[model samples]
Target: MNRLAILSVSDKTGLIDLARVLVESYQFQLISSGGTAKALKEANLPVTKVSDYTGAPEILGGRVKTLHPKIHGGILSRPDLESDRADLTANDIQPVTLVVVNLYPFEQTIAKAGVSLEQAIEQIDVGGPTMIRAAAKNHQYVSVLSNPAQYNAYLEELKAHNGETRIEFRRSLALAAFSHTQAYDRAIADYLTKEILNEAQAKIDLMEVSSTGATSSQPSLSSSYTLLCHSPKPLRYGENPHQPATWYQLGAAPKGWSAAQQLQGKELSYNNLLDLEAARSIVAEFWNDAPCAVIVKHNNPCGVAIAPTIAEAYQKAFAADSTSAFGGIVALNRPIDEETAKALTSTFLECVVAPACVASVATILAAKPNLRVLVLPEMQQGTSETVKLIAGGMLVQKSDDLPATPETWQVVTQKQPSPEQMQELIFAWKICRHVKSNAIAITGDRVTLGIGAGQMNRVGSAKIALEQAGDRTKGAVLASDGFFPFDDSVRTAAAAGITAIVQPGGSMRDGDSIKAADELGLVMVLTHVRHFLH
Candidate 1:
C-alpha cells in the first residue's frame, strides 16, 4: 500500500507543486476535498476526494464531509496496536500518512466592511481543524502539514531522506499544526466577543430610547468571555533594570501595538514600548491630510503639533519644548519624507515612528544605527478597550475616545472664547487628554508651547507650563486634564499672562475658579467631560 497525503486548503499557493512531488517523487497517494480536489485534478494529478474516499456524500452544505469514521480512523490509527490496525483493515480504510490542511478564512471574513454575524460564523472551519488535530495527535506514524508554507520543507525532507520523514521532523510539524489550530480558534473567539459587545451596545441604545430590559451578558461587566492575546515576543527588560518583560500582541490579525514592526536598533524595552504607544496614540488623534508629530516622554505628551508639511510639523513640535524633545520618542501621522527625516536627525532623538518612510529618508535615518525606527502602516486606524490590572481583580473600561464638539463645550466664564481661540482650545484639550494627571498644556496657534505632566499639584503644572511659555503665554491658551480645586491655578495663569483656560468644571470650588478667570479677563470654557490619566 502506498503512503497517502491529504490536502485540503483555503490558500492554494504552491499546492500543485507539492501534489506533483508527492505523486511523482514520493509515490504517495493524494486525497483532497472541495477546492483542493478540483485544483489537484486540474493539474492532471490522481487525487481522491474525501467524500469519495469515505464512500459518503457531503451533508449539511459541506460541513459534515470529513467527519466520518473512515477519515478519522485512517489518520488516527496506531500502527503498533494490533486492534487499531485490525479495525483499519477490516473497515477497508487506507492509512493517511500525510495530512495537508489549512483553516477557513474566518479572520478575513470578519474583516470585510459591514460583515454580519451569520457571515462570520459560517466561515469558521470545523472539518479542517478536526483533520489537522487527528493527524497531529497521531504524529508518531502521521505527518500533518497545516500550512502551505510547510510544503516546500516537507518535500525537501523527502528528497533528502528518500521519501521517509524523521520522528523529530514529524514532532516539529505536529507542534506547528497545533499552533495553527490554536490561532484559528483565537480568531473565532475574538470575533464572537466583538459580536457580543455590539449587541450589548444595541441594547444600551434601546434602553436609552425606552427603559425596558437589560442585557445579561454585557462585555464590559462579564469576566467569563475567552479573550485571547497570544504571540509573545520577549524584550530586553521591563521599566526597571532588574525586572523582566515581554510583548504579547492581542488577537490573530495584526493591529495597533502588535502591528508595529521594529526595523532597527536594540530590542524594545518596557519603557520604550510605553513611550512609543503614548506617542503613537497622540499622533493617531490627528487623522487628516495635514502632517502631525507628537513627542512623548515618561508616557506623557511633552510636545505635539500639526502643520502643512512634515518638516515644519516636526520643527514646530520639537520647538514646543526642545528641552523635553531631547532623547524623546517621536511619532508622525504621515509618511516620513526626506525633509522630515533630515529635520528629525538634527535632534538626538531616541526613536522615530511613522506609517511609512520614503526610501531616501529611510536611508538617511539608517545612518544613526542606534536610533529605533518603526514602520507601522496601521497607525492610521485604531479603536480599542483599556484593560487594567488591579488588586485581587481586573478593571476593564471603555477607552477615552470621546470627541470634543461645540455642543459639549460650555462657555461658563463671562468671557466667551473667540472662534479662533475656541479651535485652539479644543486642540489643546485633545492633547491634554493624553497627558498624565496634574497636566497642563499651554498652546498658541494650534501648537503646544509648553506642557507640564505628572506634577504633584495642579498649580505646579500650571506654573511649570507657564514658565516654559514665558513670552508666548501672552496669547497662549491653557488646557488642564482635570478640574481645578482652587483659584490658585487661575491666579498663576493670570500672573503668567495666559489668555484662556479649558477644564472640566466639576469641583465644589468651581465658583471660585470661575470668578478668578472672570476677574483676570480670561476666557474659560468647561467641557462637562473629564479626562483623568493617572
Candidate 2:
C-alpha cells in the first residue's frame, strides 16, 4: 500500500513544493482539506479532499470538517498491533503515516486592522490542533511536520533513509507543536476574558497572560503561564559576616532602568541595583539636553551636578561628597569616553551607566573586572506614578511633577535673584525632588555643594545641609524638598550667605519664612507644592 500523507495549512508558504515532492518523488497519497485541496489541484498535484475521504460534507462553516473518526482513526491506529490493523481494514480507513498541518492565524487575525471580536473568535483553530495533537502523541508511529522550515530537511531524511524520518526528529517536532497551541489558546482565553468580559472578571483574566509567544508553525498547547518567585543571591555575605540575609530584584520591572544595556563587567548585585536605581531616578529628573552626573550611595544621592561637559559635571559632583563617593554608583545623561572612564577608574566605584561607551574606553575599563557598566538606550524623563508598599497594601501617588515653567514660580520675597542665581536655584530644585523627605539641597555654580536628606525636622535638615556645604554655602542657592515648618531654616540659610531659596510654601509658618527672607536680603520663591521623595 502507498504511504498516506495529510496536508492542511492556513499559511501556505511552502505547501505546493511539499505536495509536489510527496506525489512525484515519495509516491505518497496526498490528502488535503478546503483551501489546501484547491491549491494542490491548481498545481496539478494528485490529492484527495478530506470530506471526500470521510464521505461527509463539511458542515458549520467548515468548522466540522476534520473532527470525524475516519481521519483520526487512521492517525491513532497502532500499526504494530494486528487488532488495530484489523479494525482499520474493517472500517476501510487508511493508516496516515505523515501529518503536515498548521493552525489558523488567530494571532495575526486579532492583530489586524479593525478586526472585530467575533471575527477574531472565528480564527481559533479547533480540528487542526486536535489532529496535530493526535499525531504528536503517536510520534513513534507517525511523522509530524508543523513548520515549513522542517519540510526540506524531513524530505531529505526520508529520501536518504528509505522514506522513514528519524524517531528523535519526530518527537522534537511534536513537542514544539504542543507548546505552540498552548500559548495560542492561553492568549485567546486571556484576551476574551479581559477585553470582552467585565472589570471584576478582567482582574482574574490578567493573571492568565503568558510571558512568551509562539514562534513555531505547529499547533501545540504545551506553553502555558506559570508563576514562580525567585530568591535573591547575596554577595560574599550580608551587611556583615554575622548577619544572614539576601536580596531580591523587586518582582515589578524597573521603570527606565530596564532600558539600560550592560556593556561590560561582573553581574550586578542587589546593592548595585539599588544604588543604580537611585542614580538613574535622579539623573532622569534632568532633561536629556542637559549634561548631568549623579553619584549614589546606599540608595541616596551623595552628589549631583549639571554642566556643559559630562566630565566637568562628574568632577564637580565628586568634589561635593568625595568621602561618600567610595564604591558609589555613577549615572550620566551622555556617553562615557576614555578620559571620563580613566577619571572614574581612579576612584573605587561600583558601576557606571550611560547611553553609549566608546570601544577604547570599554577596553580600558575591562581591566577592572569587578566594575559594572551599563548603557541606557533611552532616558525616561517627566512625571510617572509612584507605588509604595505599606503594611498590607500599596500606596499609589503621583510623582513630583514639578512645573519647570517659570510662570508657575512666584518670587514671594523682596530680594529678586540674579540671572545666574535663578539658574542654579532651578537646577537645585530639580535635584532636590528626587531626594528623601525632609531633604535640603545646597548648590553653587550648577554643582551640588551638599545634600541633607532623611532628617527628622526641617531645621535639622537645613543645619546639616549648611554643615555639608561648609564654606561652599557662600554664594550657594538653597532648595528644600518640602516646605519649611519654621522660619529658622530661612535664617540659617541666610546666615550661611545662601543667595536664594526655592521651596513649596504650604506650611502655617510660611509667612515667617517669607518675612525672614525679606529681612535677611534673600531671594525666596514658592513652588506651591512640596516634593518629598521618600
Cα lDDT computed for each candidate against the true fold: 0.86, 0.81
Clashing pairs for model 1 are none
lDDT, model 2, position 345: 83
**Could you give candidate 2's per-residue lDDT for residues 384-481 as a string of tens digits?**
55667679666766665656655688899888878888888888888888778788999988888888888888788788889999998898999998
Q: Which stretches of candidate 2 lie over 4 Å from their true place?
A: 1-256, 381-383, 401-403
Error of 2 at 253 (Å): 11
Best by TM-score: 1
Off-target runs (Cα >4 Å) in candidate 1 are 14-27, 42-45, 114-118, 139-141, 151-176, 196-273, 289-291, 334-339, 354-378, 388-395, 456-460
Q: Write the per-residue lDDT of candidate 1 for residues 176-246, one digit (tens) a residue.
A: 98988888887777678777888888887887677666544455534453445667888887988798888
